[model samples]
Target: MRLAALLLCLALPVAAQSAAAPDDMARRAAAQLQQAAAGLERAGSARDRVAALTRTIRAYEAGLAAMREGLRRASARERTIRESFEVERLRLEQLIGALQSMHSSPEALLLLHPSGALGTARSGMVLSDVTPALHAEVEELRARLEELATLRALQDGAAQTLEEALRGVQEARTRLSQAISDRTELPRRVTEDPAQMRRLIESADTLEGFATSLASLPADPAAPDLPDFAAAKGDLELPVRGTVRRGFREPDAAGIRRPGLLVETAPGAVVTTPWPATIRYLGPLLDYGNVMILEPSGGYLLVFAGLDQVYGRAGDVLPAGSPIGLMPGADRAPAIPAAATEPGGQAPDETLYLELREGDAPVDPRQWFRLDED
Candidate 1:
């Protein structure tokens, strides 16, 4: 009996060790998962930014291409103008040659007075009538010459415009394609009915009012778990680097207060998320163009709108600074110098509207985004 009892005691320790092994492994696995989640968030943010820049760069390049095409059309018109002027020049030259031939050699035969006083009087009358006609011919020739000079200048201007468009194309294309390695991989956390969400979005009247309804929606459990949203506070980078055109809650021309921020950026300026979050909705809303909403935390939703084009859809897990979309430039805005565009390109006259909501209550984005005074 003692021998059997001793064996049982030994087996118990072995069993306990076996039981602890799985628990220890599970704890380690959980830790690794958290760490991987954080890493994914950062990588996603970087990729998102690249995507945004790519979108904007493409828009700028498209504009340059259109301008070049317009320039080509203008050049064709200038060529037509030059051809017409050439014909006018030849006609004027022929007239001058004929006039010179008639007047180049003057004979003293008339002054000889074969018939005396009557012949001299008739010659004087003939000279007076011919004088006015010569004056008219000279004036017509001078006007035709001036028209040719104007046409030449017009052609020169068109050439200059074309050359400028050509120069912009290479630079814009280079910046967009430089990062060939970076590609976006937006993970689908959960299957969402985009049509359903968009319908819900349309039903709401105001941004603040709509976001309140969105706050109640359940989060995707399968979403890659990332770090805390508040951890990025104060140190949060602006989604897109540009000049702040309007402050949050600032009154406009009619004295109506704006609840969000207006950032003026180059056409095709890349916009990224400021925190790890999931995209809840992406589509147009009222006067706001293409809109995207990111839920950074349980109750907070970040709103970005006035985009020329949008990226990703609902249920996408995005890391901080991930590219979501682009700020629009004027569809036909003139090209500004390189100085006008940052490492990016020239900003369009348009503005990106940014609003933050905590369960439907509007919060000043100025508090969230770092901005310059005034």
Candidate 2:
């Protein structure tokens, strides 16, 4: 009887050791499961959440296997230990089921598991001391999730604002392009003949008379530099660089005979004056597609026409050699022999005609330009 009691004592310790191994494994699995749940909640990106969930599944599998192995080796008197393990297994099964449900419905998971859905365990009591640590981890994760959600909202709002601004800029550019197209067509409607354009010089004479009258009549003591005709006559320089194509002549049946020196220039070239002058006129004129008339100090009227673009405006004071406009078109008129054509070859089909005037008449522009001598 004593021998049987001794053998029983030895068997009891062996059974206890076997039970302890499974219990330790179960505790470790529970701790890992809790840690993984917290990690999923705290994860800032999708990849991080997936990794945490995977780790939790591995731990749960290991613990389950250890518990089964312990039960197989346990004795009859230690059946209570086996029964306790069975209860734990059932609890784990329920947890895994809840996780599966959450995985199927992310929105529902977010609502039910604000702490975050787990891969193996969804809802279960861990060891007593472990509960506090698990709660702290969950709270930290909740805070991080809230921050991520707020950032996403702000980014969406910013993208929408930028899209609206880009749309406005596109609309404005379309309107500007349309306006330019309209302005380009203006010259086609105004003048048909060069002779009529020469007749228009009468209007310029009328304007000069008006200017002279105003100069004589004005005198507020504060009014600046009243027009000095003599000073004006000597100070201004020629407006462009080119040879005269037509010289001033008496009016004939064909047209008011050329009343100014028509300067010929290359197409698409920049037009400018050799001296500063105030812009007197800027727009379409008879026989001139686009025109700019500048009145320099000496009653010198500098005229430029046949332009594709105008960079200045009426009343602007332009510096010497400043760009006024680009010449129009690319095709150059074929040069016909002087004897084979009209005296100056002044025809509508010709590509050149930029006239200049001084006071009421035109002068030989060739005499004023020093650069042409070279």
Candidate 3:
């Protein structure tokens, strides 16, 4: 029922412009956007404004993504229906001509066949079957044409809504960023030593070395203990929403294997901490782009690399699902290319490198993270 209401809202005109009837996914997009808007409205009153704004931004992102996929489906379906209609065009024209001739012919003349009475009776039986089949084919063709038109109109009308959704998500992201910068509620797990952090980053030439050095740093004596990391094995969520493009120690194009999982996500997607953890390091290191190293427990580190921007600071303890960073890219909603919008198109543009380490040894992150596989 909620979906139906959203669908009705999607069908309404914007700025005196009529909207096309939405598909199921389009209806879903509408609902998600509505939810995001509601979240945004209530964010000012929420206890944790950053979390509320994060949720709003995520909702907007999900809605925009759905709308994009819906447009792609509509385009593909329209192309298919148009192709089918063209293939049947000549046959349909001939059938229409024959039907018109038969309608104009005298009733007795139509009954008389070039054969004897027995043959005429058989011919009548065949005509009775063929007539219904022909009518059905004509009806099917009509329906396909109508569907094609609807799809085409849907793609046309969806552009404005897509633009609005994109703008809304961007605004939400901006608000979330500001909120995070102003946030100071999280506890500090360690005292940051600029010199020590600089030495670790400058002296280490590899991820393993950097991670090992970070682990040797001391935590504050007064810091509170976090939940057991080992107990959450196989139940932790991925830091970001994406598909695992490569598994742990998986070989790349050059056959060089890394002890991490490569996750492909949409450009500028949000990255969060999946568990309560303290930030040990957050910056560019080695060849792993922008990285955020977290110590969820003693001797256990979760590393997220390839971010566009990092949030919070070293030693700040974050609760689960806290926005830690964003994947590298512009915040604008994607204008998917023709090939990408097609069925079974290329994967998303950005890739995040994730690794879990226990006492300086890399472990299979898939074993710890519950992933939604492609």
Candidate 4:
């Protein structure tokens, strides 16, 4: 019983050393989760519940992402340990047999050697050296087994946490939609003329044409002044949590190319405004899904295509990090099991098409947004 307790005590440190990265990630994710929950509670009385809920939703996303990564790493480590054990199975068996024979042998027989006194003395010295090494191997094997058990426990616990995060994010999204509907606080940059907008939408045959026509519309003289959008180059955050699947002007599977980024995102993921901008247009256009056109400054248009739902109204001036829309897809399930099946949890649920234009001419968005390398 004492030996068993000692093995378990030693196993903890060994497990921590082996799985340090994953364990650290899990701890960070847990902290994020707590932050999200706290944000949700505080949003009930917050002056800007929309912004608070936005932060909550983002926290949930970040937490879920980190948790998924940790689980993936843990699963990989577990597989590696199992594989190592399989490769050393024969050697382990021999070691165990040797230990068992030493333990069960009669003391008199152990001392008695077939050879003379000199041979017996030499054998005793050899046994003294070999016994400690054999014991060390046994302890290591026990440690590995304990680590494997710890990993399994961690994975099991992660399922509940993932589920909680998913539900929390969904609740935050629903509340954000409600808050947006209830909101009448944001100032309009321009009072949109229905007839003029209809005429422009009907006449434009291409995105460039549409953008040029939209630019021709008069700006509100009383609109609030904002910081220069040009000065924000290389410092802008992406509107959503996603990976850039296609770079600017990069060809797609059909060999067609566009002067924009194609970002892959999870289903129902929240999309935000990367910077303060006036909504020039919102709704469906051409082959694109639901779209949003933003004007951060004169002669500049930031276009986001392929949203499932859009919030706010045309001409509404929104602040940076404002919830704009969501990517189309069903809610994610508790992803612990999925992490094992699909490590990294990066399966794309939808694609967001982003375009930037200056004077209706295309420019690479990568020059502006701070995209991390995959």
- Comparing 2 and 3 by lDDT, which wins? 3
TM-score of each: 0.50, 0.32, 0.87, 0.88
* lDDT of candidates 1 onward, in order: 0.57, 0.41, 0.77, 0.79
lDDT of 1 by residue, 146-215 (tens): 5445434543444444344434433433333443234347666774567857766778897666666777
Residue 337, candidate 2: Cα error in Å is: 18
What does candidate 2 score on TM?
0.32
Using TM-score, rank the candidates from best to worst: 4, 3, 1, 2
Residues 1-374, model 2: lDDT tens digits: 22223223222221122224433443453454345344434432444332233333233223323332322222221344445435545443444454354357654333343455562134332223334543443354354345334433433333333233223222322322333333321111111134533445444444334233222322223322324433434343444333455555645467766544555543333355555666655666545677666555544565566665565455455545555554553234222212212323332222234444656555544454542420
The prediction achieving the highest lDDT against the true structure is: 4
Q: What C-alpha lDDT, on a 0 to 100 scale, does residue 283 get in candidate 1? A: 80
Please identify which of the two predictions, 1 or 2, would achieve the higher lDDT against the true structure: 1
Off by over 4 Å in 2: 1-241, 250-256, 331-367, 371-374
Screening candidate 3 with a backbone cut-off below 3 angstroms (N, C-alpha, C), the clashing residue pairs are none
**Whole-structure CA lDDT of model 4:** 0.79
> Under the 3 Å rule for N, CA and C atoms, how many clashes does model 1 have?
6
lDDT, residue 237, candidate 4: 86
CA RMSD per model (angstroms): 31.5, 34.8, 9.4, 5.1
- The reply for model 1, stretches above 4 Å from the true place, is 1-184, 337-348
Better of 2 and 4 by TM-score: 4
lDDT of 4 by residue, 79-192 (tens): 878877777665555566666766898755665566888867876776666556556766888888987888878787888887877778888889999999999989787656
Q: Report the Cα lDDT for candidate 3.
A: 0.77
